[model samples]
Target: MASENQIVVLDGATARTGTGCMHGISWFVAKLGSTLAGLAADLDASLPSTLMTSIQAVADQHRATCDLLHPGTPSAVVALLRLNETVLEYLVLGDVTVIIDTADGLQVVADDRVDRTARAEREEADRYPFGSAEKQAALLRMKHAELAARNTPGGYWVAAADPTAARYAITGKIPLDTIRRVAVLTDGAARLVALFKLMDWPDVLELLDQHGPTELIRRVRAFEAADPSCMRWARNKRSDDATAVYAV
Candidate 1:
C-alpha cells in the first residue's frame, strides 16, 4: 500500500514451463520491492539510483538461487513512487502502470514498447481457434521472439537479471498538490482501462473511490468469464494475475 511517502508494485513475468525459475519470481519481486522502499525511505535517493540498486540486489539474489539465469529466468514489471512535500517522483519499468488523479485531469504512465512488440504475435495467434495446436504454437513463437529481443536497443526492456535495464526506466515528477489520488497496478488489473477499454481512466478512479479494487477486478473477471474464447477481449491469456494499490 502507498502512504504519504512512497509506493511500489510488481508483476512477475508470465512463465510457461512448469520448471522455469519463475517459481521463485514472486518471492524475488517482493524482496526487491522491500529493498526499493527501504532505500527511498532511508536515503531519500533519486528514483533512478534506487531502482538501479534494487535491480542489482534482486538480480544477484536470483542468480544465487537459480542454477541458470537466462532471458527466460523470470522477471517482473517495476512501478515505484516517492512523495515529497511538493512533488511526486516515479519510475516505471515495463508494463505496470501508475495512474494519478490530478486537479486538472487524470494522468496515466506506462511503458508500451513491450506491448507493441507482442501485438503482432497476438494478431497472428488470434487467427487460430482457441485451444488449438496452431494457436499454441504461434504463442510459443511469439514468446521466443520476445525473449530474444529483451534488453536490446530495438526491443523493449524489463527488470530481469540485467541491472542495465534499470537505466531504461520511464521517470518523471508531478506536483503533489495537484494530485487527488494515485493507483499502482499490474498490467492484469490495468486491463480494466487499458486492454478491455470498458471504462476510461476517470471512470476507473471513480470506481475505485466508490467500490474499491476488488469490485474493479471483479468486473474484469466477469467480463472474461463471459467470453471464454476471448472473442470479445482477445488476449494472450484468458486472465493473468491481478494486483493493485490505491492511495488518496
Candidate 2:
C-alpha cells in the first residue's frame, strides 16, 4: 500500500480526492524514525514526507476518476512512511500493517495489505512449494496459471501473478524515544508470531535485542532460502512477499 514514485520529504499535506476532503482528510504524517530502509524501486529513506506525496498522487487519481464518473473513486490507497525524516507520516489502503517502536517497545501503527480474499488464496497456495518442494511437483502435476489461479484468488491480491505489483509495505514508522530499536517486516515474517510461538512487538523486540536486527533478518532469509521456488507464494503463515526493515 506504499505510494513511492519519487523520494524526499514534503512540507505539507493536501487532499487530492473527494469533495471537502480537506477538513476530515487523513493525510499521512509522522515523526521520522532512525535507520530507514524504504522501497522506492528497491528502497529509499525518509517516511513522513515520501508518503505524503504518494497519498496525494493516489488521492488525485481517485478524484480524477470520480470526475470522469459521477463520484467515481479508486480503492483507498496507503502510502509508505519514510524511515527517517524531519517528520513522521504514512498512508494506507487495503491492509498493509505498520508497526512503531516506542519506549514500551514495538507496536502496530497501521495495516494495509492482504484481506479475506488474500488469506484464502494464501491457504491454498500453502500446500505447494515456494513452501515445500512437493508443492512444485504437485503444481507441475496440475497444468497452468488457470489451475493455480483457481487454487488461490484471482491472483490480484494473493497470488504473485505479478511481481511488480506484489511488492508492498508491511510495517512503517518514526519510533521516537519510546523505542530503542525496531523491525518492520511483511505479514509473512510476522506470521512467525503464531506459527513459531513468538510474542508480539515486545517479545520480538526482546529477541531482536538479544540477537540483533542483522541476525534477525539473516534467520528469516535462511527460512526463505530453504523453501522451494514457491517460497514467495507459500500458503503457510510466512510465505507471501518477504521483507524486513530494522532500525533504532
Residue 215 error, candidate 2, Å = 1.1
How accurate locally is residue 36 in candidate 2, as Cα lDDT from 0 to 100?
16
Candidate with top TM-score is 1
TM-score of 2: 0.42
Winner by lDDT: 1
Worst 10 residues of 1 by lDDT: 15-24
Please give, for residues 149-172, the per-residue lDDT of candidate 2 as tens digits. Answer: 321334322111122222343333
Show where candidate 1 strays beyond 4 Å: 1-4, 17-23, 65-69
Model 1 agreement with the true structure over 55-173: per-residue lDDT tens digits:
88876765655744565777788888888768988899999888998898888998988867766776898777657788789888888878877788978988877778888999999
